[model samples]
Target: MDPATLIGIALAFIIVVVVNVMEGGNPMAMILIPPMLLVFGGTLVICLAGGTMGDAKLAMQGMVKAFTSPAPSAAQLVPELVTLADKARREGLLALEDYVADLDDPFLVKALTMAIDGTDPEELRDILEAEVHAKKAETKQAAKFWTAAGGYAPTIGIVGTVMGLIHVLEQLAQPEKLGHLIAGAFVATLWGVLSANALFLPLGARITRLGELEVAQMELVIEGVGALQAGSNPRLVAQRLRSLLPASQREEEAA
Candidate 1:
């Protein structure tokens, strides 16, 4: 599993605690249960109200994916596509069928299988591109759920803070306890802002980024499959696919 999300979130909380200690504040004081429930629980219900149950499921799945799934690598697929191109060029498109059973990527396998089945180049492109678009839409919806939660969290936090302040105001007769009550009241706002910036927003952004990477890899596969169907040269297919990758990844391939 990719540790980026885990590490980043852990570090963010650690930094917050460290800063609180540096300011001569009790870190444990910020861990109030009422505010935690209000901000986190309130944000969750509001987000659910804004979207359907399907979106919630997708969001949860996306969250798991963000924390666990490694980024897709289009650069790594280049060599494989080039090999397929070379094989098809030498033994013809029919030869690619032999390689299909051993291939791991379902996208590549599907594309090559269609090509081997004598699917028209234009029809194949249309079908593959349509699948890519559908995937993009799914990921977009999943990311939207988190983005909405991030947007709602701070506002929910403010509401919690206001409620806390209302309680603080009721204890006005106890002047000696005013400072402690005031501090405790603001914990709602703190958790709200903290969860949004450190957790929710980052997860939303990560899901979007991961989706883009996966889409890029799919697009690369489409192009590679198209080239193979058209009887393109292996070197040219390699060059075309490489051009679609980032400079950093291209450099890695060269190395």
Candidate 2:
């Protein structure tokens, strides 16, 4: 599992608590149960209401993926593609069938299998590209769910704050308790804004970024597979695939 998201979220909350204490506020005061439920629970149901059940399922999966999915490494695949290109060049595309089970990436395996089975290069490209497009659409929907939640969270928080303020107003006769009650009322607003910036929005962006990375990796595989099917030189295949990577990764590969 990727630790960056976990570490980042934990650090954000820690810093918030630390800063609250540094400002002479009791961190526990911000932990009001009513506001917590209103802000978080309300936001959740509202987001769910906005989307279908399938979208909700995708969003939950995306949330897990954001915290756990490893970043794709297209750089690593280049050498493997180059190796396949070399074998196909030396022994023909049929020779690659012997190596299919040894390949780890299902995407690469599928591409290589198709190539070895005498799939026309154009048809293979079309099929793989279609699959990539479908994946992009699915991931896009998942990320959209989180992005919608992030947008709704702050508004829900404000609603919670307003409700709390209504309750505070009812106790106006008790001037002695006004200050504490007012502070508690504002906790809804704090949680709303804090959760939006620190949690919901970040998760949405992370999911979007991960989707993009996966798509990029798949695109690289498509190019690699195309080169292999064409029986391109291993050196040319490596150069072509490396060109598709970031300059930093290309430099690392060269080293």
Candidate 3:
């Protein structure tokens, strides 16, 4: 699981609760049903209307995958690619076929399968590049579902705030209860803003980040498969693949 995602969410909630308590504010005062239903329900209504049901499902699945699935370890893939490069250079592209069934990553399997089938180097690049772009586009659409919700949330909160103000004005003759009514009305605004920033906005940002990581890993596959097809030396292939990583992660490959 993604510790950072979990920790960030937990910390946000903890800080808010602690501060509320420390300030002598009633933590329960924030729990109003109407404002919450308006912000959350309204956001979902617009998001679903804007995108397909499949897109909404994918977005939820994407969020779960982001938190639960570990990214492919490129450090491990480097060695595997080096081994493939050496075997291909020694025994030809067809020799790599022996390892294809054993490969776990479907992307790698497809790219290497094409290479073994004697696909032209440029054609191989085009095929893999197209797949990469298609996958990236799909993932991006999933993220847009959440981002659209995030964009709508704050504005929806303002609508709730206005509704609350209207309720307050309707009972304006009761001067003694005006302060309480005003505070209750503002609670809708709080729910909207907090839910947007704390939940939807952050969820969208994390989905985008996870998409970038996934695309980078797939690009590495393209490079690895290309190098194997080109008959580059094993060590040189390893070096080239290692260059795709950030400087900090590159050090782990060295070790």
Candidate 4:
């Protein structure tokens, strides 16, 4: 599980609840069913109308990924690529074939398989780059769905607030109920802004960041495979892959 994503959401809710308690406000004031339906249900409508049903489904999946998907690290990959390069250089391209079946990452396996099969380097690069681009595009579109939801939620909440006020106005003659009615009406606005900032927006950003990290890892794999296929020195392959890591991480790894 992603601790950052989990802790961020938990912290947001905890802060709101604690502040409400300190202010002598009802702890349950934020839980009105009508406002929730208006904000969340209306967000669904907006999301569906803006994109295809497939995109909506992918966006939901992306949210789950944002919280649970473990990102691939270049640091871990560098050693694997270096070892493959050494084996290929010591024996031959055919020697790498045996190791392919033992690999867990399908992407790396496919790249190595193509190299062993005598695929042209240019053709290989094209295929891998296209696949990477398409995958990133799909992930990006999924993130955009959440971004649209965040943008629409606040407006939908305001709409609900207006609707509630219209109902409150009808009870104007009953002055004793006016204050309670107005406070209840504002709950819709609260639901909209809170959900937008705390949930939808953060989820979108997380998905996007995850997508970028995935693409970066794939790109590193492509370069590593290219080096191995070219029969480059193992240290050269390791150096090229290490460039993908941050300066601080590079230093630590070297140490």
lDDT of 4 by residue, 190-220 (tens): 9899999999999999999888877877898
Candidate 1 lDDT: 0.92
lDDT of 1 by residue, 121-194 (tens): 99999999999999999999999988888898889989988998898899999999889989998998999899
TM-score, every prediction: 0.96, 0.96, 0.91, 0.96
TM-score of model number 4: 0.96
Error of 3 at 203 (Å): 1.6
In candidate 4 the C-alpha lDDT for residue 204 amounts to 94
Model 2: CA > 4 A from native: none
Q: Report the lDDT tens digits of candidate 3 across residue range 1-255.
A: 666766787788778889989999888888888888998999888899998899989888977876777655566677778898899999998887879999988888999988888889999899889988988887888878878888888889888888888888888788888887788788777777777777777777888787777778788888988888888988899889998988866887778
The RMSD (Cα, Å) of candidate 2 is 1.2
Indicate whether candidate 2 or candidate 3 has the larger lDDT.
2
Clash pairs, model 1 backbone: none
TM-score of 2: 0.96
Model 3 spans > 4 angstroms off: none
Error of 3 at 219 (Å): 1.3
Model 2: pairs clashing at backbone N, Cα or C within 3 Å: none
Location of the lowest summed lDDT over 10 successive residues in candidate 1: 1-10
